[model samples]
Target: MKVLSGIHEPTKGTITINNINYNKLDHKLAAQLGIGIIYQELSVIDELTVLENLYIGRHLTKKICGVNIIDWREMRVRAAMMLLRVGLKVDLDEKVANLSISHKQMLEIAKTLMLDAKVIIMDEPTSSLTNKEVDYLLSSISDHESVA
Candidate 1:
């Protein structure tokens, strides 16, 4: 799985997605090929708002006079759409720390979905969830697959 995520390289092998050979897929190539991975450990930053977390790694920034400026309005619009797709309704500006564990998990899925990830690799998705949370996650995945 780490190999797929570009975190590790295979010693001797070939990875072909849809028959296209990615000799040694790095993070950029993996993302372009719509591959995303979600580990069991919660990765949402507690100090940031839901919106901030969504755009944390790859902010919608544009270069302007040698300065990188984040496009806040565009990000908020897209974040709202992603939340809707995930069946979540958290305030975009609300701190992640204030959300329940289930909600935080949902946020992570939303991020993956936003990447337009055709193939998602989840590691122990329900490791620390309540039975109820587990049910919610499973149901959400079912719905997503159906639509996909």
Candidate 2:
């Protein structure tokens, strides 16, 4: 999965996506190519608000007085939509540390969706989820697959 996500390079074989062969790749390129990964370990920042976490490295920005500033309104709107898609309903300003484990997992899925990822590789996504959460997560994935 690390190799596929461009965290590590393959020693031999090449990776082909959308008919393009990549001999070398990096995390940024992989994300731009719609490849997203959710590791077994939760990656969401506990101190950050839901909206902040959603747009951490890729915040929407607008030029104001010749300076770039985060477009908070746009980020909130998009983050809400992404959260809805993953069946996660929470305040955008709420901190992640206040969320449940299942909610955090759902937040991870929402993050990937916000990236417009076409292919999501989840590593033991259900490991920490309860039976009901697992069912919900599976249903969400199936729905996303059909739509994509």
Candidate 3:
């Protein structure tokens, strides 16, 4: 796999993105090439809000001279938009610990969308959801792919 470079011979087969081979790219460069992964076990911050969990410290780049400050308002708007895009309607200010499992999963996806990635890999995202919830999620993914 290109992720781990287990294929050994990079020249034999190339993993290309935007016409560039992934095997030739550095780890950080490859990571930044629009690939995002969401693990089955979420490591979200319990104390932070849904919006804060999504943006973390990156929300402050607008007003802050350095990376030390966070622009709460901008982050909230972006996080809210991402939540809307993922079809989850939750209070962006609510703590992650208070959210239900389904809501948490949606929030995690919303966070991924906020990163503006071209590829998103979800691992067992609906393993624990109810039938209705799973249907909704599958439908959403299908709808997105259809449009794409």
Candidate 4:
């Protein structure tokens, strides 16, 4: 399969999300348009916890007010919900490296979910998963419409 995205300047094609053209959108706006990607091999930080991995690029701490802290409580709650939605029972605070292959993939899915992404691009999502794991992953994906 082939996928074309990003800005294609001096090119005939255009990519759009929610009616906004990629060429007209800036990097930050494009990011907010919600494009989640998951590679065959997990690209997560081994040392970070599941919750931390989910918030790797975007920090929840930045949303806090003066007296309000990162609201880790909220992040944890959302992470737990995402894990459950993805059909995994993992410790939100557990390190990514300590997880099994299936668990890691599940974590990655949950991480993407936390981003509230509208489009998800997955490459070889089932490459390293067991039969059962693949089933779960497929089922999870069927619940959403992605650009994969």
Root-mean-square deviation per candidate: 3.5, 2.4, 4.3, 3.5
Instruction: Write the residue-wise lDDT of candidate 4 on 39-124 in tens digits.
Output: 67787788999889988766665444555457687778877878877778878889889998878877877776677778888777
Q: What's the lDDT of the predicted structure labeled candidate 2?
A: 0.83
**Model 1 per-residue lDDT tens digits across residues 1-148:** 8798888998887998988877688888888888888877788999999998998778897788999999888899999988876667799999999999878988887888778677888887667567876676677666554222
Sorted by lDDT (best first), the order is: 2, 1, 4, 3
**Per-residue accuracy of model 2 over 17-81 as CA lDDT, tens digit each:** 88999997899899888888888889999999988889888889999999999898888888887
* lDDT of residue 71 for candidate 2: 93
lDDT per model vs. reference: 0.82, 0.83, 0.68, 0.71
Backbone clashes (count) for model 2: 0
Tell me the TM-score of model 2.
0.86
Q: Which residue segments of model 4 deviate by more than 4 Å?
A: 1-12, 18-20, 23-29, 61-65
lDDT for model 3 comes to: 0.68
**Which residue pairs in candidate 3 collide?**
60-71
CA lDDT, candidate 3, residue 45? 86
lDDT of 1 at 72: 89
